[model samples]
Target: MGRMYGWVAAGLLAGVAQPALAQEADAPSKDSGDIVVTARFRNENLQDVPIAVSVVNGDVAASRNLNTLQDLSTVIPTVDFRNGQSNKDRTVFIRGVGTITTSPGVESSVSTVIDGVVLVRPGQATLDLLDLDHLEVLRGPQGTLFGKNASAGVINLVTKAPSKVQTETLEAGYYEGGEGRIKASVSGPITSTIGYALSGLYASYKGNVFNAGTGHKVNGYDRWGLRGKIVARPNDDVTITFAGDYLYNRDNTPQGVYVSSSRIAYPTGVVTPNATLAGLLAQEGITPSANNKRVNTNFDSEVRDRNYGGSITLDWRLGGGYTLTSITAYREWKNHQTPDWDTRAILATGFPQGRDDGTVDFDQFSQEIRLASPQGGLVDYVVGAYLLAADTYERYQRSVTQLIGGAPVTNNGVANYGISAQNHALFGEANLHATDALTFIAGGRLIHDSLSYFHQRVSDTATGVSGIRPSFASSGKTDRVDYSARAGVQYKLASNANTYFTFSRGYKGPAYNVFFNMQAFDTQPLAPETSTSYEIGLKGSLFGGRVSGGIAAYVTNYDGYQANFADTYLGAIVTRLINAGKVQTKGIEADLNARPTDRLTLNFAVARTDARIKHFNCPAATTCTSIDNQPLPFAPDWKLSGGAAWKLPITDGLAIELQTDASYKSRTQYAITQTPDTIQPAYGIWNASIALIGDEHWELRALVKNILDQHYANTLAYGTTAGVVRYVPRDNDRYVGLNARIRY
Candidate 1:
């Protein structure tokens, strides 16, 4: 392992925020606009349930100017997400556990589902964020509901269902940050029992933000997306839906842009990369458009990207207080990109040759069928089946040039890697009411997984390395049988207070990366990583429901750790995977929502977690010792955030609203080996939005991220070429102006 995970006192401030203040039990809360989510896989009161859940509805997304899942974390506490190097690259860690890669061969620890269909690859899931009904974020373990691949939790995107009501919305926005975006959607009933919706998105950036002055070239970004959906209700007892989307963006983007931590304490170049670094210079010649680094520095790039996907669902009523539903979906996404990172790093220092034109293709299909009941009863049962298959291929060309007898000699290199995974499973959950205040949930799953890996690499006469055409073929098939049991005793201690204790178990399948990549080195197979947990919590609307909140504490143990890392010696890079020793994470979490008046609402969340190696005997097999005694990489022990939304009565049919969010994270090491290059320092950020929402159909919004004008990194990586590591900075300051529509 190259890094150690860290931990914190997770639930120290659990009772911080209050739930929504809209005081009604039968209808949805007005505090959270339309598009309420069924993220918990059940329809229940968001404030009443005991799960750790956060929701982002339609209006909230548009008003906040959130374009990708990475941007959503700014407003939602307990969520840490990012897309680095490539738009296809994304990592989402909830409760401090997740993977960092867009490579299909690597799977993310956290589970993601869209409209009940599992998203096999992160790249396919990175498609544009369009007209969605709502996004449900469930923190902690979701092993019971999500099955394999859900060691952490689940993030569900529930699209807007076909509605009988007709609606139309169009949006146009521009930013001082050299960015422009527009989106439009329309929906109406095709028949008494059928409905459909279609949408489009277009966004572009002029590539001028980095301010580096290099011909003002590599900083711009451009993209477009489309979405289509259909719903059919043949009878009162059955409903069906079909949907899909596509998005493409080109980026000649730059990365690794930094500034002086303190204007007076240091000079920019003294702390950041030198001018015309090899990595940056190489990017200039290829795709200099979507330079995220340039977007952060002098801001310039010439790059582009495209993403797309679709789905279909059928729900049927089977009478006898029972209902059955089936959801089938397919997704296809591809990206053609170019980068000059190495060139930028070696620009003037003689390492000068680096160029790569890369492309990735990802396609997936999934189907799930489940049944449940909405009636409150003493005993009930729910069962379902899920199947998923995905195929991904990535290919790239990189080259270096040199002076041969004063003439340039070019060397070209190519690498190809892919992953294909298919899963079939059946799961069941049975719930029993032991008492009026006690409900128990027990579930199990039987799954069969087929995992395959394909890899090949070639180096032309230019780069010095020969092509054995290193390639391996594996159709590894493994069957996984797992179960999750939850027993909870919810007791009414007081008139409005309910407290409960629960026990559960969950796991992430043993991925094939450990074997496939090892095959590249002609090695053997490693083991799988798994976890089990126990939790205790108390929740209920206190103070006559005026202030609602919950606090929970949990302990979890992890076994069979899998790690893939890189080692460089003599200027050459080597990569491998190893199954390490055991580790554990224990923590506490809490959140609150309070409304003091008709126009003011406040919310806050705080988490403290402790994640570390219980025993790591990697390089040495004899005696057991800790792996650097450092906290896990990317896992922060302390995180806290609060927000207040206030609506003012400015005039008739019009209201002025303001929202503010602030967050802080204690610093921690990003990788196993502790060096200046990979350690991430602690930092905080604030964002605010002011908007005018009107009656009938109009909205005007203005927002400023990094309200304090703080320069910081939301996501980062170290050691691009060994020893020389730098932090990648985001465009810390961005302000947007937006106009929107509605239909009554």
Candidate 2:
């Protein structure tokens, strides 16, 4: 089925290839308009870039109510986002490749960059985006220019700049389930040479999960943030910009909900009821169900996160049309969480039963300098150097009570871990115009990484439980150097159309599994991951600005893919990161935007991905089965998204607008082992909105999300003692809301 779609896409590319129309000039029509992008570190027309990229304009995002990366994933079929126990564990995937782990020493394969500053941790990008100018998602490896940790791809976000004219904006919204939000911003010129912008936001939600024990909502949040920017011209030849932001978030959402008590036998593919877990649940008068919406926990979970950052940028126009750019940045993230591990209201002989508290502190400093030659020459180039230094510290404490020989017993333990890292890189890219109709592109990066870790564990009392481990201390260090490169050629089929093919090499640094449960064997540094990818794409416009879009096909293979698998630690089920063997992902993607008339617009996107394991290096002392051909977790075979908008004039001073969007994905497996209990069935969601707009001052909108009230899990997993558990998302139920905005 996937092969068929690939062929169809290839045919479409061929059909669009036509001889250059000498009558038509080699430039885009004025009616088509132009989208400017910095995908290659320079402003260029989107259709001219030889890469597979997608753009989301800020105005379109505002109308769709997209507030975070997770929200953006629904409209981009080639990307996927997953949430975990807390913000620190969230993960993002592009082209079926991503790293999933809680170790601070490890970096994500997919990187996030905001306003030219790369984020040290993926969790830092989870904050609500505000006043965005636009967003770009680049598929496949992007390490040649973006640098390390971009082996899979990159998500680039650009915020609105300070305005030359004075402006003030205010917005307020209220949704079902007691969710409310307010936002305001002001921008203008401070002087003839200096301009400034300031924005602030506040939001609150009264969760959806019902806590049967406490008679209150369990998964709710309160968030607020502030951002400011200043731009100064200084002189006709130089420009300086400064930016800073701070955010605070607090929530009480548990790791997951108990969904079932079914267990599967290891290595035999047998399913049966977990009698032991069922007996324990019955003691507390609890029954597990697939549609479970209530949880009886004795304690409330708490997660508090604080993030802040600042950056300074300098751009200088040198002699002979040469440009020099420098950027320096510093950022910090601190998080503290208290979770109820047991998820039950059982009475025990302890002050606080079945609870764990953890804290993390991370900081990073980075500097980048680059120079670029002027465009429209036979040969143009960009060269850059990057340096990064980062450190992370974590502290964890666990307390639990269990029945030992018909008597209640209590146990307590604590663990501390720290990691330090440094990275340096030199990168460059150049384009050679062999002819007016043909061009060649090449880029490469040389990177060096140094990483080290320290860890210690201590127990307050000796217990007979098999899950307890002896006190221990461990440390390790590693260093390595690697390189990534890309080569491609593009041919202009016509004035408004082009075709290109490229090969890329991607690399990710080595890592250590330095977590709370780290043992002697885990001290060894895991092998670095590497990949090679091949891609062919075509981009163009048709019908004299009526249609514009792109189509691409890609295949990527990875060695030493980093993933989490189920294992046994001291007679208890546990999950740990390992260098899972080889994996390959091949797919076809297409996106289209059309303006049939001045009153209507339509957009569509689709992806057919086949991500599978080519080899499995089964870890010793672990349950092993047939998994060589299993699909990677969170990867679906097919994904699609489409939307439409229509504008109707009510009068000379007012108008009515209608919009709707829909998305769908095939079934997904949530575990590497392909366990039946960890499968999420296929699902789809639909949303629509109606708005009334004034000439240029104010607007009101009414929106409905999850129109079908689809009930599905965001993710599924096997619990150590609770059998199967699932994460319930906020959109599992239908909801409606109203938003209002004023501009002056």
Candidate 3:
């Protein structure tokens, strides 16, 4: 992102050089233009909200420290994540569309939603970093208003509430490799209508940025979090709020050791791990040879996660403008992984192994109610109701042993499972007018899904007579109901010029964790994939509101698709999810945010996509002639991003903030005759940050990410392994320092 558009064009050119060097000649204006967002739920004014949303705040996500959610797409230009040797992986795409599956029973095509609940798995999407109040990147295919898994779009995380008067904050920081962090918050008023708030955070890191030569010790990452809130407005119209959060992390992710290999060839492409097969540990007594040399010397691994959630919100104001809203939520999450798959056999001998332990558990429940109508007659309204329930199960086993010289003959691996789902929904939206430059918009959603999967496994030494068994409740259980709708039209040549057309009927609800994988003594269940989308757009503002832009075009149709393979059932080598057949997609997108003066401001976005498979028959397209048409694994058919920020306030708590960003995308192949192990090449990187607020009660910031350490790769193979050796980390260097405000 061209170092984030050169730090926002050097803080709007030092705030246009402090009033053109007139030495602040007449202060008083922080209008701070643009930055009004609600991501369609009515709050309009995001240049009129036709769609394609993106808003950032919470002080630019905490002065760019960005904490979690894997750094939110290097400044939000569609988003990205997929890293080395698997760190619980993730895949997200918008505009070009996307779906991710790694077989813990698949599920996730974007739909993170926090503050309105709905965080459907991926270990609840890496939490922590609170005290926020903005983050909405809406985009496309919200399945008629965000239905089951969203089909590639929706990430609304809004926080920051619980202040009735008394407020406080405190923060500390240090960074430049060996990291550190601290945070605190407070809010008051426990009477006269009630209120309360509390927050806490702590972060730690070592995550060694690589100096590689293969070794024996490398520390990992660590984190911690806590949040709480409560509010009540008793009388005058009714309002209530409650919230809770907790996070725990232990990342120690080291995985960097793959010095040599060859059976099919690792020849320096590296995938290391065969510490002489633990030298058969004394030929199998159990433990010898100095406790089996710490189990193959630290091949890089450490993961542990614990997340928590809670939410409640209500606001009622009945009269004239009409309003009523309610939200309820629940969540529980867990993750624990032990990695170190052997780095050149623990660096040729010194050893390191915490053993291969893995586990996961996530639970969720949600409820929503809504109603709002108001805005000068010709009609404007919104209504909603939704209910969702989730029960989750996940676990994988590992106890790789051979150790002849150290001792433990044979014990391979396999243990996996998942089942539970229940859902319901009702929704509506309207905006109509007959004349005066036309206007009409409509929306709908009515969906219900009920599912329960049965069958569990413990694999008794690869089917050599296991003890526990029960398969898919005798193969009977499945239910689905789907509906979607949307219509749009707008025409106006003044009032900031307008032109819009839309047709949406998106619905996705196969979500039994993305298709099937059989083997719970027989598996069957993988169906549900649907879509319909078409759009048109134009919105303009020139010279006056200081030039703004928009342009859109789209088409999508997907009948069904779900394929994942790497078979070896009775012999154990997991990963299977099938049912692949139809698909169609098309696209064009555009964006601009100009500010020709007032000391410069510019922003841009562009995209072009073409997806294929008019009919797929799998197993190498089976006579479908594999027209794979390439460029869709990590979809990047062409994209661009722009940025600029400049400001200066030498007086009044001294201010200096400059920013930047630039981007490009093209090569990203995963098949279709482009093999060189299915491509991924094309890179760009740049970044910067600086801040000093010191007394709105103290605030200081500094950040530099990638800066230009470019090594590009953020998505590729996951489970069904044919060997890709994972590498999607484009952050080679980063430095951070922050401190924040308002009474300690």
Candidate 4:
């Protein structure tokens, strides 16, 4: 850690010694004060929007090698991204609040919006981002405009639009550990009134974990995607745009490595070594330890996903300073996964060998229309109506091999389920300019949701084996009507500074635990989750527009927070989704960006989140332990991130740039049960890069991540066999890479 800090200090000193130089010809200056966002369904200066937002420009993302949400989380102190064994299990948290469940009926607390469309599922947004114009992370409840599933926050992604001028870009990168990526984009005008932009990407990475059973790396990914957009302007009053995208991904690395094995006698508070698991490990010639990167699974774990979407948008100037806009979209996503339940290849007389295979098919269609009065009016307003219809189908099978009555036996259980939903909403927001320095903002959304599900399960055995669930069939329907509202008062401190206080009400619709193990008790829909939030913030630009940032403090209380908890059923431990009684999250966040000179830029951000459960609604007939007042999973007390970049000109057409960044996270627990074994100690990672620029057409760069060779786990969980396991991220170790790009 000391060496890493020394390297950063040296780079800063070296940058200071060089004389001030002009900006790189090919790199456009991204002045923080000039950033514009659509936080309120209209273009507005970020400083005047009265919301806590973090913006990442496309150039900054490229310079920092950020291609996915997981990568972006390292730079934003208030955001955390967790990866599971498959896309369906991926989750994003904002301010220590998020939903983690595999049931299709449940909705995420954090919503992801791309362009003008909202993704129905979190997995749909896990793909690699492409050609982004900018990304805005709106902190706190955003249910007023983003609609349902935004009780916590919203991730809004805006892609580059069709450019009227002809342009082309190509980028290629290679990193240590057999990872490589290539991206290309082109934009030009096809006719006097028509313009188009197209982009494509291909990326691959070799597995980082070594699989002793197959003598090969186990966790790697291969993915490719294409995106295109067209804009047509037939008259001065109207414009139309068409956009489409497709993605294909294949990977075989979703399981975690073993950390330890132990057994605790129920109700006796006694600990003992897991002899059965130890014997299995010995038979497979495997050792268990923290940060272990080797595994000995007999079968390959694979996940294949395909996604495609298209949208059409129309904008018309309705005259008299009013604008009308409409967007229609359709999307489909399909995934297949195969996993080895036990991470060992051991043969025993009566022991169980378990395997599970599953597939998901999801489709959605949506439409939205809004009318906006032009800005500068005494009362500017926007009203919108939205409709969405979605369907999800899942097929899962669990197979086990065991010995019954001294004879070998094999049993299989299969489940098929489907969820259908429809949502209708009316939303509106208005800003009243009381005076030149004071404004009042109000927004509300009325939403109605109708959801239904059908599930069927069949087992080869009459009563099912150890790993197979019993035969069952069930169908249910639920309907919910909810509303979200927000009111705020903004006061202008100066021409470039403002302060605001806001009160908001957020809502998430009812959900049912519709999974392969659905039972009669799980058919009832969980109550809706709701939140009340109060926020105070200050935002502005200082030093004559050279610096820009914001600070915010907020407290939110939630009722009926849905979460997964462990329960005993049929003499086995099972995980189920239930509505936890109450939770409270309070935090303070601060961020700043400064361009002290034309050739230097600096940024820093910090957050302190205190998220905990206020009450635990223990289920009936279960011997549940009390976890009240415990910190929420993945909610670190403190988080910080900072970066510095400096450009020095060597000649009229050549320049060199130096950049460094680091992120720190305090200790955090990974389990809702608050087990001591699932705690992750504090850790920090540092990264640096150097680049050479030539005449505005081409450039080359070299970068290294995890300069200290930090060893840490992204997530930790209790294993199925009375042990603990952890998921190791790719950047868990030191790696060096090179990147090159060209533009015309």
Candidate 5:
């Protein structure tokens, strides 16, 4: 950690001589020009905000073919996400901080907010990000203003809104291997005081992997989405906006490519395959393959997801130089998945050798009201109140089947769980300008959170199995009050150059471990996790708004740290959350842009993170061991990314553009208690694109992804008996595509 900071200090000192210039202009900004963001709850120049945030424009996403969380993580430093037992369930991590449990009782430390509305579950973050105006990545604790669950950070998505001008855009593209996609959007004025916009998208791709066992293609993808928006301005002082959207995704389950081991552990430390496993494999006509990309499963594996939502926002100006804003939103998400947990056609020990089902149904509602004094005052203030209500239902089913005396025996078991939660918060912030160049900010939030949970299991087996838990029923309720606060001071040395330091405390309410191993549900409530973060940085514009960026360093300390432990029960893999004691995370981040010439632009960003458990003692439940000083899982030590864009004019109405970007990550750990087998080697990826623009609102583009064709696993894990198993569910290979667009 000391050596990592040494380089960061030297780099900052080297750039100290560069002259910094003023506030960013409001002209149309692209790749590296005067980036603007809403990280501070208002539209402000990125370089002026005293926070560490990365803003990516919609044009950049369109040119780079970035449509998924994995793709977005590549360009942003200190961000990563992985699939859970079900691919639809995504777990996002920032700065080595995130949740590993996908159970209904657990919530993610990282928050995903779209247009000021926060999502309730990690699965909701997997929805397709479309028609986005910009994406903002805020690092460090943000609970003081956003919410209590934003203990790690926040990802904000802002979509394009209705426009007054009449316009339409159409685009189509084809990738290698017969995949096709199309997008359309139209917006215009409907009346003197109203405007409307409509947009839709559809895409499909043939799977790359073939299932020899079932003689069907595996891992195919199908997606569709639609959005409608309306904006009304009845008077000069009142404005209202209504937005609604629906997205559907259906894809084959990305089962772990089997490597080895399929047996339940016994008390005597003996392992053996299922009694009738060999016969069942033969009956299913499955031939074992050594290739990792091949699928050899007997059961059907797929995931179907539906996400829809709507929000209405009202902004009104009142008497006495004040403005009022109100927001109301409701959303629902449902996912059904059948995953081949065993990854093989053969059965293990129990009656149902391979797992069959998992489901999650979630609904959420939110409202926020805010009143603020107009700008241009020595002391400015904003006060707000927020409320959220959510409900979730989860179910899991197991197919209990075995071959007895050459005859097939079958039974079924089901587990059902429910959780309901409500949260109320009052938050306010005020800015005090002491001098012309010095300003102070302070904010705080008071939140009351409550939730109820219930779980039930049903089965006919009278005798309990050695490794599996029997049917049981349990219910519990928990409630708590959490508080978060923030304080910061900014000093401006010149019109454009400024440096600031901030201290913030964030809180996350207690969560349950709903995925019971039958080892008891920890009737006692789990302790809530809390973090104190300190950050200092320098940011400013330069070269007349053509070049702008920032450098920041932050350190965070955690109490009652939460982490995961993976274990096997009844020949099936399961994960459990534990209070892993105190942990500390320290990191340095730097970003810069240079537009030496009007036609060429370059940008660079780098981050180094060191997250480790400071203290942890073994628990009394099992033979668990202490993991002191161990680095957190999925936290990379170093990440570097950069890009360059160059444009050339051909004629008065035509132009050509070339853009390229690349990223490299250092060795990362997949298990908190790291082992030689759990470490992922360092890897890099590159993307390049070329485009041509015409005078009549027409454009053509060509893009290549993973130019080196790296065959690295997105998520890698290794076990004693299982050599290696990875969740390489999608896009592990290189891709080439061409797209064309027309606008009127």
Candidate 6:
């Protein structure tokens, strides 16, 4: 069946190509009005780029309310976004590969770069999106030209720049069961040679989760942010730009609930279920049902996050048609959260207080200087140098109410960890216009990274009302050198069509597990992960822009795949990071766009992934369950998404537009070692929006999200004591909103 589908897809491409050649004498196809992006360090048409890339425009994002990464995934078929235990934690997967740990010293496999600056932490990428110019998702490895830690792929976000023309825009909206939001931006010329722009955003929401125990709302949200940018042209050949932004957010913490009680029925081993904990939750007024509305917790919890950053860029057009560019950036990020560890209100033996407090801070600085020769020459080249320095600190505290001298008292344990890192790199890429129909490209990078860390763990025993002293310390340092390379050939089939094939190698740096608990294996840092990928694709327009499409197939092999393992240490459970051997993923992705009429447009995207762990062997202190051929975690085999839009003129100055989109995903497992409780069944979601525009200056829109009110677990986890618990990070109920915007 899969082979038949593949054949049909290929046949459709061939059919389009045959007609395109037959009409060679005809006029060239009209532009599809497709977006342009800077994914390859230069502004180019999306279809003209020799890589598989998905572009989403600012207007489309505003209409779809794509304020977060999770919202963006609905449009990109191969992307998946998952939140960790806290709402502030983010894990983004592209092409079925990504980093699994949010600990300090570990970076994301799929890097997120904003305006040419890479976000040092994955969680920082979850900030609200406003005044965006466009977002580009580049599939496959990009480490050769892009910076390090891009073993999976890259998500590039470009914001609207300061313009010479005066413009102002304001938008406000309210959601039925979600939130209220307001955004404003203004741009104008500060002087004949300078331009400035400022933007601000505010949003708040009373979450859907009703806490029956405390009579207070859980998972509510509140946030605001501001950004300013300035551009100056000292001369016709030199330009400089500066940008800064600050954001603050606070929200109630999320609580996990039991989804299923079924245990893995191993023939030789006995596993216990959470019957007692389930009964206690029920007794505490917690109700777990299809609606998933209520959470019972005796402790108070909240999440607070603050992020601020700035960047400066200088560009100069040198003699001999060469361009020199320099980018310098600095950022600071801090986040703190308090969580109810037990998810139950009852006072149990092991989790009497059931409280865990954690805080993380990061300060990062980076500089990049690159020079590019003019394109269209017989041979063009780009060379660059990069430097990065960062400091990270994390503190965690776990508390429990225990009996001391027959009286209840609190006993707390605390752990602190810090990491300092420095990285330097030299990279270059060349494009050779070999012939009229074919071009060859090659790139390589040499990177060296050094890291040092200090950590200590301590505990205070209950002293009938007071406490005791602290414990020991540990320190370590390590450094290594790594390299990446890429080679590709692109053939121009016609003025409007192209075909390309590329092979690339990517690398991720080594990391240490920075959790509070101490496990023997976890104390030793894990090795770096690497990947090699091969891809081939075709892109072009058909029928005078009435139809357009691109299709690509890629295979990636991973060595020393990073994975988290659960193990026992003196009767207590601890998670250790390990290199779990080889993994292979091969997939095909297709996208189609059509403008059948002047007022009607349609688009669709589909992906099929075959991702599996090729080899694995558990380390000591860990149980070696049978998982040799399991599918990679959170990777669905098949995904489909499509949308349509229509615009009709109602009067000389008024028009109405309607749009609808839908997405579907197949069943997927949540953990590397497959378990029945960790599987999330197939589900689908639909969204729609209608807008009224008056002279393109004022507009009103009505949007409906999750029109079907689909019920599915956002994430699932298998716990030793709690069995299976699912976390629903988003509201399950349907959401409806009305927005109004004006521009001048």
Q: Which candidate has the top score in TM-score?
A: 4
Report the Cα lDDT for candidate 1: 0.60
For candidate 6, write residues 221-327 as lDDT tens digits.
79899989899998899989899999888877565666654356333345566576667667877545434666777755688888889999999999788999999
Candidate 1's displacement at residue 634, Å, is 1.7
Q: How does each model score on lDDT?
A: 0.60, 0.80, 0.58, 0.83, 0.73, 0.76
Candidate 2, residue 626: the lDDT equals 66
Point out the higher-scoring one by lDDT: 2 or 5.
2
**Model 5, residue 701: displacement in angstroms?**
0.8
Q: Which regions of candidate 4 fall more than 4 Å away from where they truly are?
A: 1-32, 263-272, 349-351, 405-407, 568-573
Q: Put down candidate 1 lDDT per residue, 1-744, tens digits, no spaces.
A: 111111111111212222231223224555432223465466666654556677766546665666667766655656676545566555777766666544455566678887787776665555457776677787766766674577677888766655557887778887766678888778889888778988888887665334344556444567787878888889988988887777777765454343211111011123443334435544543223212344222223234555666777777888877889888778777777665544243233333345556787778888888888755788777788888888888776666554446566666667677777777778776767777666666666666666666666566542252211233343444445555444555565665666766666656665655221224332233455666777778766655555677788888776765553444422333334445567677788887777777787777777888877666645322232245444665677887766667889788899987766666677755554333344456656566667788974777778776554444555444423322423343345544455555554
Q: List the candidate 1 regions with Cα displacement exceeding 4 Å.
A: 1-37, 207-214, 217-220, 258-305, 343-352, 401-410, 461-489, 492-496, 514-519, 522-525, 572-575, 617-628, 722-731, 734-744
What is the per-residue lDDT of model 5 for residues 428-463, given as tens digits with 9 covering 90 to 100? 887888887898989899989898888887755545
How do the residues 1-744 of candidate 3 rate in per-residue lDDT, one tens digit apiece?
A: 675455345434333111110001011222323335556565556657676666665545555566565665555555554444333545555654555555444456567787777787755665555776667777666755664657656877777777767878887676666677777889888898988888888888665433132442344467778888888889879888889988887775444322111112112333433344334321322132110112123245667788888888888888888888888888887887776443323211222122456677768788888888877789877778888888766665544433345654444344456667777888887879767778898888888877665434443354331111122222335777877777888887687768877777666566443222344423445676666777787877776656566777778776775544333332223444554556666777776666666645666666676766566545431223343443345556665556566666688667775665555556665432223433556554555566666546666667676564555445433212112333324254344454455464
Candidates by lDDT, descending order = 4, 2, 6, 5, 1, 3
Better of 4 and 6 by TM-score: 4
User: What shift in Å separates residue 663 of candidate 5 from its native position after superposition?
Assistant: 0.7
Give candidate 5 regions above 4 Å deviation: 1-32, 85-88, 259-291, 319-321, 348-352, 402-411, 462-468, 516-519, 617-619, 718-723
Residue 329 error, candidate 6, Å: 0.3
lDDT score for candidate 6 against the true structure? 0.76
Candidate 4 lDDT over 460-487, as tens digits, reads 8777556577899999999989899999
